[model samples]
Target chain A: MSGCDQCALAGVLPPAPTADPGRPRLIAIVGPPNSGKSTLFNRLTGLRQKVANYPGVTVEKRLGRARLEDGHEVALVDLPGIYSLSPRSEDEQVAHDVLAGTMPDFPRPDAVLLILDSTNLGRHLMLAAPILALGLPTMIVLNMADDLRKRGGEVDAESLTKQLGAPVVLASAAQDQGLEPVWRFLTECGAAPSPVDLPALQDVPRCHAWAARLGRHAAYQPPAPPIWTRRLDSILLHALWGPVIFCLVVVVVFQSIFSWARPLMNGVQWLIAWSGAWVGSLVPNTWARSLLVDGVWTGVGSVLVFLPQILLLFLFIGILEDSGYLARAALIADRTMARVGLQGKSFIPLLSAYACAVPAVLATRTIENQRDRIATILVAPFMTCAARLPVYTLIIAAFLPERPVLGPLLGTRAAAMLGLYALGFLAAFATARVLKSSILKSERTPFVLEMPPYRRPTLASLGLRLLDRAKIFLRRAGTVILAMAVVLWIVAHLPLSAGKVPPIERSLAGTLGRTVEPVIRPLGFNWKIGVGLITSLAAREVIVGTLGTIYGMEPDAKSRGLQAALRSDLTPGGAVALLVFFAFAMQCMSTIAVVRRETGSWKWPLVQFSYMTTLAWCGAFLANRIVTALA
Target chain B: MQANVIRRRAPASLAELRKGEQGILDRLDLPEDVSRRLMELGFVPGSPVVAALSAPGGDPRVFRVDGSEIALRHDTAVRLKLRPAASAAAN
Candidate 1:
């Protein structure tokens, strides 16, 4: 306790909370978007954090437990970043509600960790006014202390603390420096101080002025803007080269996630198969063995195959986002997004949609406007994701010939794949336009975004983010996907005769496929393809694995080999229809589940599902007719 | 909103300020919420703003104000009335 110093704040503070053993003290971590609140939270909690939604909102709440230096445990609720107390979006509403103790299932925070960037205190400091108005025990965490000192910025923490009637500490979550004060603040005697005069909650200029005056009185020296930021922004935001370079970047990211991820995907696939076969060899010809290998292993493995790609995608997103190039990309995309009735912020999320719509939907939280966010969510699935890649590759390779479409420049197989991508992109763009002009209509949302200076991304932050994403993916695989696989295996093998599983035609799965065959026959699909379509509702890419199993079950399909099996089974028109159908169908249960969670209700996801499925069916029917006539 | 109520003779909107020029914000001529957000970002009256650069599409222009770079589209930036940096400094 030699380092403990409370001489200046002795009488001004109350004893810290968490003295009660039953209910741990809850401290709200609040800050602007770029304040390093998350970094601080990650540091304080380490791996103790769990992210869940705040009851029924689209924004997620991150709750983590941390232990103080004196061995007292406390819970930290990290709130979404907001500039002020006045709520404009769901993110702000969550923050405001949590602070006011009005949010359902959330306790009024015992204390507030007000994090602000020390280098940009003039602008970041305005958030202090309304927060202080909450009259809660608060400590101003001046984060990015290293950046502050490096940039020649300085502040007198004692003077600022006295001015605000709260204790202040300077720390850097990135460098992991000056965190000793944080541990002391939480564990030591710090309580709700006497209320100090602050500007009205809605009075922006007054708040700004008050914060500025306090900074000056505290001897705060603002850091000079970096010279390189301007130099970089010149070419990065240039009219011609900027857009060209942005295109190249988009192409590179797209290619890397698709092509560079191939070997890793193959590795994951091989591991799953080898383990499944090895485990299966130990079990006899019982249902348990079939269930173990075919149901759980194959089902989870299909989803897990995309893990490498997802991690790679998140790695790129984290780097681009943390290093601040995503903002520039968003600005460059604003004009094109405007054409589709969205804005710049929707660009990165939509680009990420091509990698996977699940993260893309989560990314929409960055857009401040509710209408725009919902609109983005609705259209995100129309961007063909990595889940659809295997289905596309299998079909295109088997059904289409490799004849050149434009001499040697383009092949028919490649052209078909590009067409599918373009089809999905057009559907997304058109749907967004329709949605904004109708249900999601709103007045103009001001696109006022702060351009943070580009900095090198930390390995810790990116690695931790990828770890979180991987956990979420694995959790999905272990739960819903694993269960679905088990159920599917039972359904396909049910109504056994003489205590033995029947053939694919006599089994329940065959009857199930046959029953739906008539409905899809007009689109040129048979019972085999119908089975693939039905099972793929678990996830789109499951169709590839299911088709492999389906043919393995039927007698004639096993002889022609797999690729030849598809070539013999599907007609030219049927193959094109299938491609068109997959392009528009909302077949992935995970995407639907994510949509439901993000939109806060079944209403939006149901509407999206019904509309997309209808479009897909109609599209498939039309493609079948047009192709059959051309042939 | 009083952000639009002219207390002083503010000359030009921020949109009209060319790149490489500086100006002092006179007031925000926007709705209450919008102006409030801008002011919180250091668009407060009497703060110096320099037109830093234009985006590739040339709609959302970036500006340096209060030691931070912020981007605002034409519709939002047009609402920010400013006094020429030369005139404000001379005054």
Candidate 2:
């Protein structure tokens, strides 16, 4: 078929397959950031997916089985978004390397669906020129078509298809439109002809010329900024009040997550507890019962209890990002971050680090400056992530009594939680400054960021994004956290010693803790405390479970609240020391691994390890000594 | 050649530039390395520049380059120097 004609046939169905092909077609979705590439991937793949590390590399490679209308299944891989194939940063380099099959483990795609926002077709298609030049079989998915229609614009999709010499499918992922056509296009297209094979070294004028030609053929126009955006920017982007508003936004965000997720969190907690008890009742032997109840059920239950909190936090984040407030937040903070040895681009990742640093560190690939990327990686671990929530919550509940503050204006519990949240942020900032001066001693990288125009966030889009993040979190916990939990359970429950002087003291975990006691003694951490810290490195909430196991408590362990248990067992000074230790520590291994992978060096991970440990040591030492003196 | 050939000339090569000199940003041929970043910081082709400020203590040095002020370490600045501007080119 003629290459131009092939463009028209894209998104159209092919004749019935003559042979039964067992191999799956690999279709990759590519586009600029925030252009709805991820939205399209979510629509196509849904839940039938697996996130394998791109074989051996640390980058997450998502592969999903998408069954077509004809019942033929294809493997769809969602690649990291890039503005162009001429990559500047590590993430973009991963994109470029994967696309070129330069990465040893990544599979070459059979067809690429280059997603374009119909409203900004020209700028979006700048990415396409490079991909199309790769001579891969390709189709263009014109995403956000509905947004275009609202702005009094229309893409002559067919004419544009012919001009670009690739098939075009118009879709709005949020609306669930054009998905079937997209599926058909990807499955049928193979070995499509190259559209424009421009050399990589060609300068800007030629690239712009090609972009302009494509713009004319596509009838491209970027819509004017919306009225609501301009109005919001006047207040939200106000120099003085902007940071204040941003802080208020953060406070409200955390408060809402705690307030709204309470009911849901309670329900999940009830279900997991009920199921664990039910399973324990069914098992015959004591050892079997404890293994199933304490090891498997307790591990999953601990991870699952955070589900509601995680979902609510991510839900708010998704809305802010999709509506484009995040971009403005970055603009407002750009100058402030410059003083702290970070670019404004560091804010999104740092902010996301609060919910979870694993994804935040992964997201730093969006920062193009190497120094900025490295500095971001160094500081990201310092942000108190959701993993630290259990520790923070337990400590706050234990130390701060429910004394009504601003009587009748706020709940005492709520106010205490807020204070601890502020403390976490302060510790994070202080730690970031320390790291910046020492190992990450580079100058603040200058950054340029695109502030996409604001739009009303669609509920479907927000839900899809929230679900995606939760899924990623759950998958990581399922493998890494699950394995760590079982190992820790054994360490906490082993050796079958008889005539024990206190059951915990005889356990393998206690033995291991005692072995390390001398090192941790200055921080006021005993053997049991030492064990909890090690087990918690896998996921932070497990600290509560580890404490439960160490204290000889049940799987459902609410009889002795985590707070009461800590307060009663730990000396007041010891409690304060532990709080200070957790406040400055890198408690999650997943974040460290992700950082190592992203920076492509052990250098950063090692520096983060040593520096954070030392900070935790000194902070804990000071806290313990001061609290003891006061006592 | 133009009267202000030095300033108006696109940095034909970065090799011609030197430390401590000031030049108008005649044309910014942003290398792929710096382009995406410069774009993000609102530094377009027509921005201005000034002589680099030596850092105080171990602090990162500040630059009055590209309209807005920016900070960079000495190592990175060495990677970017300035060419002498013809007299009329002074803004």
TM-score winner: 1
Q: Look at candidate 1 and give me any clashing residue pairs.
A: none
Query: Model 2, residue A192: displacement in angstroms?
Result: 3.7
Model-by-model lDDT, in order? 0.83, 0.66
Total clashes for model 1: 0
lDDT for each residue of candidate 1 in A1-631, tens digit (9 for 90 to 100): 1111222233334343555558888889999988999999999998888877777778888999999867887889999988887887678889998888788877777789999999899988889877776667888999998888887889999888888888888999988998887777666537675434566556677778888888999899987677677788888888788888889988987887889999999999899999999999999978999899988888888788888888888888889889888888888888779888898889878988998888788778778778999999999999999888778887787777799999999999889889999999999999999999999986555787778888889988898889888887788778877888887888788889788887766778788899999999999899988888888888887777667777773322223366688888888899999999999999988788778877778889999999999999999999999999999
The candidates score, on chain A by TM-score, as follows 0.92, 0.80
lDDT of 2 by residue, A483-535 (tens): 76687677767777673223766777788788888988888888878887787
Task: Please give each candidate's TM-score.
Answer: 0.92, 0.75
Q: How many clashing residue pairs are found in candidate 2?
A: 4
**What's the DockQ for every one of the candidates?**
0.59, 0.06
